[model samples]
Target: MTLDARSLIKAYFAEGTLPGLPDGHFIGGRIVANSDGDRLESYDPGNGQAFARFGAGKGEDVSRAVEAAQQGLAAWRDTPPATRCQVLNRAAALIRERSDYFAVVEAVDSGKTLAEARGDARSCIRLFEYYAGIADKLEGRSIPLGSGLTSWTEREPVGITAQIIPWNYPSSTFVRGVAPALAAGCAVVAKPAETTPFTALLLAQWLHEAGVPAGAVNVVTGLGSDAGAPLVRHPSIAHVTFTGSVATGVGVMQAVAPNVTQLTLELGGKSPLVALADCDVDKAVEGALWAIFSNAGQICSAGSRLVVERSIHAEMMEKLVARTRTLKLGHGLKDPDVGAINSRQHLDRIARHVEAARGRGCSILTGGSATHDPASNSGWFFEPTIIDNLAPSDPAIQQEIFGPVLSVQVVDGEEEALAMANATEFALVAGIYTGDIGKALRLARSIDAGQVTINDYWAGGIEVPFGGNRKSGFGREKGIEGIDAYVRTKAITIRH
Candidate 1:
């Protein structure tokens, strides 16, 4: 028997350590190498230790990814909708089966608590299931063009999509955004936030095991300048879907402009939660606190702006301040209530907002400093803070802080509250807590947002079409409308 020396050594020692698996890189498709292929280390915000190193791409790699995506398009589009649904459902099931593993990886890498990470994992699975159920229901409507030869509309998949996710909710965003694109039969190249790529990498592995075709989905873990810019500017990429800061979204839009690519941007917001005088002050306070501090106020649609009627403003502010004082901030793993800040940069941003608000004469009702516990000193963390007596034009009311900070503004009446809420540049989401049905309906209809809740505060779910007007960016994700973002409509006419 003639055996190569390399093969013999591999058989002997590979099991132990010799040929270690690659740390992290592209998945589900062929990776086209570029000269600028660099490595970036993802650090745990809690411990500041490098947990994983992922590949960073350059300009040329984008072209290669686009080509690979084009190649996969035919196979993915030709796949029966039912089969695609089955594959997606299988991935969802696998997510549930290995929920704990993903939760641990997410907590260590992203600085979320195990419980919150588990919830994020479960939400990802539910997102996949939701989109999978709608795979067969995506249809183009029949256009009733009065002067047309009998017109029937067909929805056709766009060729290739470039989707960029943010670090705050990387897992949920990836699953929510990608599942709909796949269900619509479009191939995708995903650019997860560089800070949290481990969970996304693991998700790609599960997708392969779930029987998703190779090259149908790809992940490039890298910096925006290298990987993201290339993906956006690639000529073959038909669409761009992004969820991040407004500044980044603007850059993406500029890059894709040359190609005339369809774009969907779910960007930043300073959403408002209004409390009418007729509403219960305690209930409003509880709802407002959860809205502002859930997920550390990292959500785009979170009601960070509290616009309350002046009649009950003092009482409501007292209750809100009391609640804020009760919040505990520490290492996510060690605490059951609040988690560590997402990163050091985020902590700095929150501090700046507090300083600026104080400079502008806003009162710090309660909670303004980071936790000083020796055990959690290593983690980037901050307390849930409340600031009252701010004008509508205050920076805290206009800009998205993306942290656990809420600013309270007093309004004279219903009309003034509505005016203040509509003053922000973003129209992603707003909430109204009112007892009067007429007032609730009026506010809901008048608010300049994609979705409004009369008494609730949840957005970006499976059933609702979530997007924004004005600068909040266009295109809906989730629901039947989400499928429309990945496909184009064509009218077909036949005459005998």
Candidate 2:
């Protein structure tokens, strides 16, 4: 049976309401509605229709959650690593069993297609499984001291953690930090992005079912100011992991400063994609599309800035435009090539960027307007836009539009291309496409981004460290290095 907008809508409503914080925050292994009775409504971005209403958690709610996490931590800190591994593995199995349902919920909540949502669900399961596999392997070393003295170092949990996940890829992002922290024997008070909290709440339930002790994992849902700020400011929170825009990340840093908290931030990016004349134009085009167009270009590490050698610039642009035109746009459930923007506000922001670019005399090669499917006339949508005749320093190029807008710049040669690609204030992920492997590797080494891909857009796997440099923010997530963020080193010395 095909799942389209109407059918999904019917299924969603037939259940009476969307599945999420039906009562309130998930705290101490139970759902607790806010005492103040504040609430927020969640909408389906594919259409401007309200689907679910949940408690808008406040500072008091966050405080309660933190207290719960502290109590839970006291209990969980003594849990054997082997037991934690077993619980995480069980959670991973449960997530895999209900992957389809979670995917549907994600698609409705975040305005991403079913295909993308399913991929995120799978990634979430993998993260839990990966952390589970590594739980028992968090080994410490013994350092030999002179004479009868003995010394050793051990990795210990950083205590209760405050995990702030972004709206995009909510399920996967939630697990990315939470899994490692749990494996490290730390309890967590997670704040899911206000716009998309359904899957996170559901996951919390699954965690409890998987045998995670009461208060070990909690979800507090509300506006950032109401719930998020207080959670960050809580004195008991020993660590924080945030994923979002740079501006917001700075705010998080400020909030956590008073507590002297350990932090890991995955901020925004204005990544570049460099296509040399010697590269395969077909592969470059494919990579470019996957990098920027996937997820409606809302990705932080999107390859929005396309730097091409002047010789093949015209040919590349032609192919990019032709392929972009063929992309289908519709509600996420319909599985269109492109889906609605996350919200009306975000859709307008994309338009403003395009208009600003046009005002500066940049040429719009194909699309630069809001569009909609006849089936769902109320959704927020934007055309896949390609802007040319813009310099590398153009606002449209320098800033993160966070939409399906690609800025094209032609360069004289390799040096110019490198200079242009590295000119951004943000450095997260960059890509280089060239037939010369030696040249590609050389350029990759010089790129200012944290992760560079050659001939492809996204490099590495779930086990590879992923983060950024400069204004893109600090610290890393994923791989073995990712788990390190949740742990602290303690050296013990004994005199015998």
Candidate 3:
């Protein structure tokens, strides 16, 4: 709660409710705003007001960014691996220096609470640090093919990479993709989600100050059709890492198809949190609350589905509801327990999902409607909701709601719980809260998610590899495997 709040907030609101906003695409280290007259206005969801005007990029802007990255590729890739890592270490230090300001901007643009945004800023710093530490450790292996010939593999940079960041996690996603790509010595052309574009551009500028060449990192902000699509399709972009909806991810897949660009997509999730009868009920309730309520449940891996054992069903609901009802709501600047929804359209989407579930005879446990922040009374604020009495066939249980909604499904035992959990189309992350480690391991093996957590909702930090299966999209990000998308292995043999 003790951030540099007063002065930062005062400075942010100086330009008529807008912060020191960056208003143009950052290409070759320069801010280009006047090249295209089309502009996009960014609104602060906390106040439901337009506070920024930036460029609305077209295919042409994406082309310029691609050219800049191509020019920056050789110098970056040829630099000693250790030197490349030192730049990220410097960037991490810069992030720590600017953490307070970055957190404030992130909270404003993404509609997450200031506390949550601060956590994200810390996560960003750790992401860069983690990748930087491992840059030199990314080694190629030698294969023995008899004594006469020496054979070894070289891990080389995958040239220019295209990153399409999402609105939910603006800053962290930008760092998450860019950090690893740069560590792999690949120049990057990134397009931040139009809704939350400012922080990424600012981060790009900071990277230059941290010694990354200006052309080595470019941020183009615009609509997905206008800028994102073009960046994905550019032939020079050797790898593309995107995080967003399944529908949009599918489009990215197709766009990269003609060029056959290598892709890494971290998409949607209807992730489950399974609470078995033998689990510690108190811990299960705590995990359920954090999983569905954190960041207003906007994360790709948010445990939105609660699969509870039949014996503990009533007790679990009682505790979950009591804790959920106590959650506070206010503007993100105020750092309440729950903050504003990202946009009116997303708010409407959340409302429609709840209405559809209620219509299908699902029982509402506590909250099932939208409520405004009592303080500001302007932005869209949905009460943290918990829906119960879900039928197995309920769309509410199957689809990714991507909001502050947790739907509960009661199961007789572990067998039924596993079956019900895997019933969804997504396989992102799963949490199993049980005292029995052997039982948890057995259940984990059976779950289809990319990552599984035992006892906690968000169990790992930046070091864990994360992604999803089935409709959640493919390829991995974070940890050692994260750099895989930005690098390719070349096998070389020497004959004596």
Tell how far residue 382 is off in model 2, in angstroms. 0.9
**lDDT of residue 122 for candidate 2:** 84
How many residue pairs in model 3 have overlapping backbones? 0
Instruction: Give candidate 3 regions above 4 Å deviation.
Output: 1-3, 11-18
**lDDT computed for candidate 2:** 0.88
Q: Would you estimate the TM-scores of all the predictions?
A: 0.91, 0.97, 0.97
Error of 3 at 422 (Å): 0.6
- Clash pairs (backbone) in predicted model 2: none
**lDDT per residue as tens, model 3, 302-403:** 999999998999999999999999999887888699888898899889999999988877899888888788876788788899999687888889888889
Per-residue lDDT for 308-372 in model 1, tens only? 99999999988888887787665455554667677778888888888888887888888776553
Cα lDDT over the full model 1: 0.78
lDDT ranking from best candidate downward: 3, 2, 1
What's the ranking of the predictions by TM-score, best on top? 3, 2, 1
Model 1, backbone clash pairs (residues 3+ apart or across chains), number: 1
Residue 148, candidate 3: C-alpha displacement in angstroms: 2.9
Model 2 residue 375 distance off true place after TM-score fit, in angstroms: 2.1
Alpha-carbon runs more than 4 Å astray in model 2: 1-10, 13-21
Clashing pairs in 3: none
